[model samples]
Target: MSDKEQKSAYGLGRAARLNLSLEMLNEMANTGRPMDAVLSSYFRHLQDALERRDRRDLENRVRSVLLHYRRLLWWLKKIKLEPTMRAMLLADMILSENADIPQLEKLCNGARNRMDMLRKEEIAALKRLLGKEINHPDMSDAVQSECPDWAQAGLKKAFGETFTEELAALATKSTSDYRVNTLHTTPEEAQQSLASQGFKTEPCPMSPIGLRQSDAGGPILSETDAFRQGWIEVQDEGSQLVALFAGAKKGMQVVDFCAGAGGKTLAIAAQMQNSGHLVACDVHSKRLSRAKVRLKRAGIVNTQRVLLENTYDKWVKKSRGKFDRVLIDAPCSGTGTWRRNPDSKWSKDETDLSELVALQADIIKSANRLVKSGGRMIYATCSLLPEENEEQIENFLKENDKFTLVKAKTVWEENFETPYPCANEDYLRLSPHTNGCDGFFACVLEKK
Candidate 1:
């Protein structure tokens, strides 16, 4: 059979999947869009045409290439070749997918253009130099970790002795986690329902209501009855922990400040038991609208969506000192989510971090006004940087004497029956290496 006729283990033909993966990568570079968004739009029309297995294969191939994009480029550079998408994809096959080098050589030699074909000398070099290992002893720390130079220093400083371990965790594929919407069904019921539909899941260690797939890249849960029935929502365990830390109770007036797309808002509303008012506020009206749909699907009725012009909007002025709980899931560098969104690392820089830190500072100050005396304000970010996480909280505390830090460990003990895993003193800092969830930092401060 021709190479085009040879099917990959994931179900798509090798040649077809490779070419499509290259196209997707190029589109991501040209458009500056995320892989998921680009994939959705690229395959919108092909949804009906492609089988589920084929789609999964395509997604896996694209994700693998992106996950090791920097390393693949590094290998290509080491071989003294142009770092092209096609070249990187080949390197991914050899390094990540463990494809046979002889087969790759045969396939590339048959390509139409001379640029596409690997020369005999290049093939010999690939055989001599490349191995199953993506990282090399000679590689720079940044290249080995697949992060920018500036970020590598920050991550090293933040993680200290565990820097390599943290990088390994961040490099691995993200686990598929789902938070059981307690408003619709209990964790037991959700797990049972998913299991009945051929989806095997395990309870997340930290979150009581969280379930994760037994394996990576299971069929999309959106097609399952459990998701359709609102029994489960795709949420990281770390994020669910943040909502729990907020301590939203029945009949408590809460504000999900900066509630973009409202993932945490849904969790908070469920904890509120559909009683009292919950305001979901964001600068983007479209995100709030999307969250409205999720709220409805999750059977959350206690929440109302509010669009804000900025942190200092008229709504903030009107809602000052009114909420019992205010959650600011502020914008940041997204360093914590690098595993799930590897391309995001390259998209941002130190300048972006500085800007986000400033914005986060302004946001926390504005949102703090919504917290009534003795009420709690939860500041959260999916960033690993100190400037955006701990530093922001420290500055906020210095500026606002009325608000004092609440130990996350204390809240964890009060809320969860399970023992706290890590020893994060004042803040609830979670990393992929330590928490098996996305890197998240949440700090609770109460108004005196």
Candidate 2:
């Protein structure tokens, strides 16, 4: 048996698990990697020393601490404790986990900490100090929402009356969503295949082929045979909806501009029934190259990958006015995906958002060249900021008199055969609060 299999045969104790969690927490603090990536890398070293249940609980505990990162830091500072990784973890346990002080102290005895070892008195004092202000009305909006100070104003502008509700939703745990590869299997068959392997999934409310894991328990899809056979790909429901909105019917030419890792490329190809000529283009050669395996695994043959030197690569000039549909999944601040990537909340700032807004505008101008007259251009972002979504579309329409905005609801109904949800008329806006998916904004523009 492999080390992982051997270790899985005899799981680690709670203390060992806690130590691993601390190690991951500290690595995240030190390395500035995203929580999921950090956890994935650390888990490999652990070699399944923890059981599935313990493994999930450990991930949840670590994620909870990071998701409530700002609040934990605020509480730590309030108690005059240095906001070290260990301190933040303890604060998370006390305030967020509501961990028993005595048991928490006992747990820490088994967990090893490289710095800032906590004494029993400190843990008790933290419980006392943090408990008193758990819901203190004086808490700042950023701390209370666990949102970054820079993002607060923009989110308020975007969400309006439901701002707090949206932030709470973003701070909550997100489940894995998968889009069934219609090329390989039907949603019904895929569900049956997954159920056979211990996955419990429910149909996604919006996308016909999308499935949502009922809970985090059961086997992760990546390890299942269904995934290896390309029956399912891990994609958010909102993302699947966006690809469907691209409306890439079979035999039509389509461009997935900015097709990072081919998430939407795969979705669009499947929608084409593997018969269309789809070009997956990205500025990063590595990201575009990685899509080869995913494409092959999905049994997709209609798509071709392109490595662009930049958005203005010579390929764009040659391909201008050729594509029937152009999909720009523009890179943005990713504020919409904060629920799945809590660390991003602190990592981005006003300057970064401004830069992304400018970049999106530039990319839209360049990629719009690829859409033929009467063909449509689909612009999308996993961003909550209006500057990146509505404003960019508005500006594009003003500059290019030949192009007019197409109501997203019209395209949504055409693709999904159902009335669009959420409020905006011109754009498809989805949020964790309103759509139970990641926050997404998509609008269609067609040339006259």
Candidate 3:
């Protein structure tokens, strides 16, 4: 082939390949496919193409493809178009190579800037979608400021930015952390176990059993016997605090309401020294089944799992005011987890948030009835929105006059020595950037 003809053919092929990637990314994003799934599929295709010798500069080509598509996704998210429509538009735009790249970049920047102005109504809607409130102040503010004109206008009209400005300063990243299940082993033992399997570990500054990964890209979970034996269950340090705040001791009766997969439930069981009754309840049987397997692996014998299917009322009545402590790890928007699930920010909308808020309110009220008089009912979420966290607590206090916010500082100081940027007041709020943990908020409410 002539040199000129070969060069022209290569250029055309490159353009076609780039267009294909953009189409796939748009489809996955709009269809609400999990980001992990999308990335996995993209990587697999890249590997196959490389094996077939269909592409040169394989790594660079893959990187460029991802960067181009990510930019496109960011633009689509900004325009406030429905996912299906957004995907269609993205497909069309990619086909038109004459697309204005500069214009798209501008729109992405504008959306980011307006996220902090997220309206009150928009905030409420977000709460309903996640079945919880937003807790990270900074994240909430960013949403308000960077939300597109459509969302911002709607939010302003419905709920003027009555959000706490203090929270905006408190938003941070979520950390990749795991707590050592002290029920079966100590931190030192867990560390030794992990190290033996070639997994490097470092102590988390904010949490006692928490450890951070020093290296990336290894089968840490599959290779370690400690994980297999349940000496350590992968959990956020912030989540560990939920059990710590419960103050579960030997012989105490504790109920882990909404104990999906028994992460915190197992933590509480360990805290009770396996000497007390800990009932872990969830509406979903599949999650409870998984929890059972985990419990077996941990050798935890003092805990039992209950399925409350189609009978939340009956279940509540059956065990009313029967536990020394009750934990309501309520459903939430998960705004604080944006670092890990950045796509959630785009997938979420006002309608979803509204539904979540109502659910959270109902769950809290129902769970509160299970706590014995003077017993604590701790509420927690991984979200950073105030509507899900602080506001929900505020509303709960107004409706139920018997519960009072416990001083979080007291419990935090007694258990750990790390100083948080946000004061330990009525609630314990941790951010990833500031506290080096997952964005989490916990409020210990004592029945007065």
Candidate 4:
């Protein structure tokens, strides 16, 4: 078993878990792993540590600590703590789940330096001190929003100065929502089944196949028969919509060019009614293996999973100009996914984004070849930055003489029973404030 697996197998209390998380974060930050991926790794293990009945409580508390990390760091610094002291203070605060000031001071009373110093403060005044610090002009806007300095300018250029507030709100509450598996159950049936099993859910307004989930204090829906029987699969509504935009049809050839774990590929399978050839192709065979389980659970039989040697795979070259639809879920900075993985904002920068842009360009250039004449290819990323979204599509159109833009808004308006949520006419621009989902950009291009 992997080291991560071994860690999951061992038991740890809340404080110990927080310490492990901090150590892992420090190492991962050094190695340049995105906070979202790091947190996913950390939290999944924490889930394994708790009993099923107690899992939700531990999960909720840890999420709160992680979600407020920026504020916590700023708060620690404001109170005259050094860098080393800050990590210790943060761990104590996390163990207490950022409790009331008096309670927090009690938790820290045994600690040395700044934390011990804080225990001497008047109990009633600590919150006021916190407000004074976080409310200062230096701490407001992007700093207060927990977004990095370098990223704020681009975001302002995209959504104006007010985008900070929306971005900040998204940093909290990474709830578990699922997409209704239409191959097995209707949205209403799926919602009803979960409700019967003590889950609070409603049909997602934007995507017909989505279920916005709420907790009912029983086991998470993951442990329910409804899930095991393939009534639902955890998927963001933005993701469900991206699959919809691909427009797969029964008996048509489709390629999910970067089908990591087959999230979109399964959605596409339902669209195809399991009657056509659906290739779930990715560079990682491990992810494809995992995708196979989801495909089976989702009752998706028309799809075949393949490992790509690279963009220039022999299979891709041979299948050139054959697929009716090709979906490029390109790798990206994942700026749009900060709602669930707020730590990611700190890990990404222009240099990393530039590398991703080049890779995206390369993948699209090679993957587009699989689209037959007049077939649609959708270029997509879970990134709010234009450099990775609309700009990439614009540059691709310029470079590829035979491909033309397919206005996403028009397609959304005509194709769906409800109106599209975002205002961008030529490409998808889903965000937390507007769509109540993670940030995503998708644009369709058709080969001539």
Best by lDDT: 2
- In candidate 3, stretches whose alpha carbon ends up further than 4 angstroms from where it belongs are 1-27, 36-174, 417-421
Task: Write candidate 2's Cα lDDT for 56-162 as tens digits.
Answer: 87788787777878877777777778788777777777676567666565666632322234576576558665455344576787678887877888889998888
Q: Report lDDT (Cα) of residue 104, candidate 4.
A: 56
- What residue pairs are clashing in model 4? none
lDDT of each: 0.82, 0.83, 0.63, 0.74
lDDT of 1 by residue, 1-448 (tens): 2233332222434555556667788888888898888788756645544567667777888888877877888888777767777777777777876677777765555443212467666676566445558877888777777777657777887889888889878988898899999888899999988888788899999999899899644456887899999989999898898888788999999999989999999999998998899999999988998998999898988899998987799989888899999999999888898888888877777788778889998998788988899999999999888878888889888888999998988877878898876677688889999989999988889899
Specify the highest-TM-score model's number: 2
Higher-lDDT candidate among 3 and 4?
A: 4
Arranged by lDDT with the best first, the candidates are 2, 1, 4, 3
lDDT of 4 at 277: 99
Q: lDDT per residue, candidate 3, 258-281, as tens digits?
A: 899998988888888888899998
lDDT score of residue 216 within candidate 3: 51
The estimated TM-scores of all candidates read 0.92, 0.93, 0.69, 0.85
Worst lDDT 10-window in candidate 3: 107-116
List model 4 lDDT by residue over 26-129, tens digit each: 65557777654665665565555556634444344445555556665665566544444234345335334434565555534532221333533334334534
Scored by Cα lDDT, where does model 1 land? 0.82
Candidate 1 vs 3: which has more TM-score = 1
Ranking by TM-score, best first?
2, 1, 4, 3
lDDT score, residue 119, model 3?
40
**Whole-structure CA lDDT of model 3:** 0.63
List ranges where model 4 is wrong by over 4 Å: 1-49, 52-62, 70-76, 84-135
